[model samples]
Target: MLTLTEAASRKVAEIMSKQTDPVAGLRVFVQKGGCSGYSYGMSLAPEIGSGDWVGEFGGVKVLVDPESAPVLQGVRIDFVESLQGSGFAIENPNAVRSCGCGNSFETEGTAAEGSLPGEMSV
Candidate 1:
């Protein structure tokens, strides 16, 4: 299962509050790309797709697709504010290696086939 820290939940709530569209929830997914091997992606989904795993935390709905569930299991998300800046941070136990920027990661036993180069989504 995936978890979100209080700070992360609050930030998601705040962002959703400003959206004019009726967002179903925050959609988290893993796509093939990044410096390490795989990258995480997130978006405000209008509706949950079929077979999606849904969880509620801090009064917000979080959605994860089946393909990404294994990779995201036991992951903790938090919002961090520092001198450099502020943004969401993902703590993934499954990641064996991650880029210095912390946007891309590689998982043990998963091949990095089909990965493309691009900006990470969050």
Candidate 2:
């Protein structure tokens, strides 16, 4: 239930190829505790979890645990290289607000007051 840009898929595949362990796919999840309310985390999955939601985009497999499925719906991931730096950037429709760093976000029903300098309310 998410989309990954070609750049993101290629980047993930490149990184996975360097890992010593056999990489089955990418694991995407959300966890509590960030400047906002939740933060995004990703890792290379060596094996798929029993309850994970799996999808393939641009030939790259992505795994989303059950707990993160709903929150990650309609999300788009992209890899960007810029003078500022390069990394995976997430555009989440479920995020009502996001921290300046772009790694943290707050969903609807958990909206908080006061915005960080670079935070955006979507």
What's the TM-score of every candidate structure?
0.89, 0.86
- How big is the positional error of residue 63 in model 1, measured in Å on the Cα after superposition? 0.2
For candidate 1, write residues 1-122 as lDDT tens digits: 99988999999999999999999999988987778878999899999999999999899899998878888989998999999999999999988899898889887745453333233335
Candidate 2: stretches off by over 4 Å: 109-122
Model 2 score (lDDT):
0.85
lDDT of each: 0.86, 0.85
Error of 2 at 17 (Å): 0.9
Give candidate 1 misplaced runs (Cα > 4 Å).
Answer: 112-122
On lDDT, the leading prediction is 1
Candidate 2, residues 30-118, lDDT tens digits: the string is: 87778988888999989999989999988899999887787788999999999999999899998888888777898874465333223
Residue 90 Cα positional deviation in candidate 2, in Å, after optimal superposition: 0.5
